[model samples]
Target: MKKRIVIFGSFGKVGEAIDRDLKINTNYEIIAPSKYTEEKSKYWSRNNCDYDILNFKEIKKILINLKPNIIINCAAFTNVDLCEEQKAECWKLNTDFVEMLARATAVTNSHLIQFSTDYIFDGLGGPYSEQASPNPINFYGKSKLAAENAIKSIDCKFSIIRTNFLFGYSRIGKKTFVDYVLDNLSQSKPIKVVDSLYSNPILTSDIAKGVRKVIKEAYLGVINFAGNDYVSRYDIAREIAKLQNLDTNLIEKIGINDVEFLANRPIKAGLKNQKALLDLNLKFQNLENSLLEYLTQLKISKESIKEISKNKN
Candidate 1:
C-alpha cells in the first residue's frame, strides 16, 4: 500500500510546484483540493491524482474518509498589507485554518507539513536560525507565528518550514518578485526597489524539492529554508534588468523607510540555509541564477527587442 498525501492550497505557488514533482517522480498517491468545480478541475488534476473542493469542514471530512498518511498545508493569507487591514480574515485563514488542519491530521495519526514565512521575525537582526525567537512586527507575521505555535502544540509529528521571498508558477496568478519585475520592464516602466531590506529569495521549485527531501528523509523540527544567496530587492531588480538587457540604471534604489507601505516590513529577513543543506543534503541556487532560470523557463526570449519596443512606443 502506497502512502497517501493530501495537500491543501494545491493551486498556490509552492503547492503547485510540489504537486508537479509528486506527479512526475513519486509513487505516493497525491490528493489536493481546489475551489473550482469538478468539470473545471483540470487546473488541479494531473497524472491520476485526486481533486476536490475543500473548506474547513470539507477538509475534516476528507481526512476522516481518506485517512492520508501526510497532510501538507500550503493554504494561507499571505498578503502582508491586506492582512494588516483584514485582521479577522487573516487570522481565520492563516491561523485558524492551520489549527484545524493540525487537529484533523492528528486524529488520523498523520504527519503535517506547514509552510511559514521569514516575516515571523521582526527583521531587526541578521540571519535567523530555527532556534531563534520570533517577534512579528506586522499582523501578517503575527498571524503566521500564531499558526506555527498552534501546529507545534499539537501532538502529531510536524515540520514547520520557514522560508522567505518566494517566487514560483501557479494556476491562479503571477504575483512573484520575478513576475513583478518582468511585468514592469515589459511596459518599459522605471522600477523603484528597496535597497535596505535583504532576503534569501527562494525559488518555488527549490522549495518544492526541499519539501520532498524532508518528507523522504522524515526530518522533524522547524527548518529555515531559503536561497543560499543574500540579496536586496534593488539588487534583484538590477539583475533582472541586466538579464533582459534593459538599463540597470532605470531601477531606482531607495531605503526601506523611504517607502510608504501599508504594513511594516522586516529589514533583514534572510535565513541561513546551512541546516537545510546539512540535514536535507540540498543545494540552492543564488537569486540571480534563479531569476535567469525562471525567465528562461517562461520563454521570455527576444528580451532586448521587447524592451526596445516598449521604450520606443
Candidate 2:
C-alpha cells in the first residue's frame, strides 16, 4: 500500500517541488490542501488546496479523518521584517500552529517534516554544524525556534530540515531570491544587496529531494540542508547577473549596519551540508549549474503562460 502524504502549503515553491516529484513516485500518495478549480487548473501551475492552515481546530479535524502517514508543512510567515512588525501573527503561524501539528501528529503516529531557517543562529560565526547553538536575533527566527523547541518537547516523530536563502523557480504570488536578482538586473534597475551576510543558499527542488530521502530512510533529528557554496548575497547577485548577461552595474553592495531593518540579521549563518551530503548521498549542484537550470525553468514557465493565454484567445 502507498503511504499517504499531505502537504500543507502545497502551492508554495517548496511544496510545489515536492508535490510534483512525489506524484511521479509510486510509493507515496500526494494530497494537497488545495486543488485547482476545473477552469483555473488548465492555465495556472500548482492551483491546489483550500483549507485555512491558520485554524488549528480545523487542522485537527482533517488530521483525525485523513490520518496521513507523512505530513510535510511548507507553510509559514517567512517575511523577516514583517515578522518583526507582526509578532503575534508570526507566533500564531510559526509556533502555535506547529505546536498543534506536533501534538496531532503524535496522536496519529504521523511523521512531520518541518522546514526551518538559518536565522535561528547569531551571526558571530558559522558554516555551522547541526550541533551548534541557536540564538535567534529576530522575531522570525525566535518564532521558528519556538516551533522547533515545541516539536522536540512533544512525543511526535519529526525531522526538522533547517536551511537558509532558499532559491528556485518562480510561483504566482511568491518570488525566490533568484527572482529578485533577475528582475532587477534584467531591467537595469539598481538593487542593493548585503555583503556582510553569508549563506549556502539551497534550491527548493533540492530541499524537496532531501525531504523525500528523509522519509524513505526514516532519518531522525535536525538536518542542515543547504547549498554547497558558502558565499555572500552580493556575490550571489553578481553570479546571477553574469549568468543571465544582465547589467552587473545595477547591483550595489551594502553592509549589515547600512540598512534600517526592523529585524536584526545573522551575518554568517551559513550551514554545513556535509551531513546531508553524506547521509542522503546528495550532491548540491554548483552555483553556475543551478543558475543555468533556473534559467531553463524561467523560459519554460514563461512559455507556459503564453500558451495558456493563446489557448484562451
Q: TM-scores of all models?
A: 0.89, 0.92
Q: Name the regions of candidate 2 deviating beyond 4 angstroms.
A: 34-49, 311-313
Query: Candidate 2 has which clashing residue pairs, if any?
Result: 33-49, 34-48, 34-49, 34-50, 35-49
**Deviation in angstroms for 173 in model 1?**
3.7
Q: List the residue pairs that clash in candidate 1.
A: none
lDDT of 2 by residue, 102-123 (tens): 9999989999999888999997
The list of candidate 1 runs beyond 4 A from truth reads 37-42, 45-54, 300-313
Q: Model 1, range 31-100, lDDT digits (tens) per residue?
A: 8766665643656545434433335787687787888888888888888999989999999989988998
Error of 1 at 70 (Å): 1.1
Scored against the true structure, residue 49 in model 1 reaches a CA lDDT of: 42
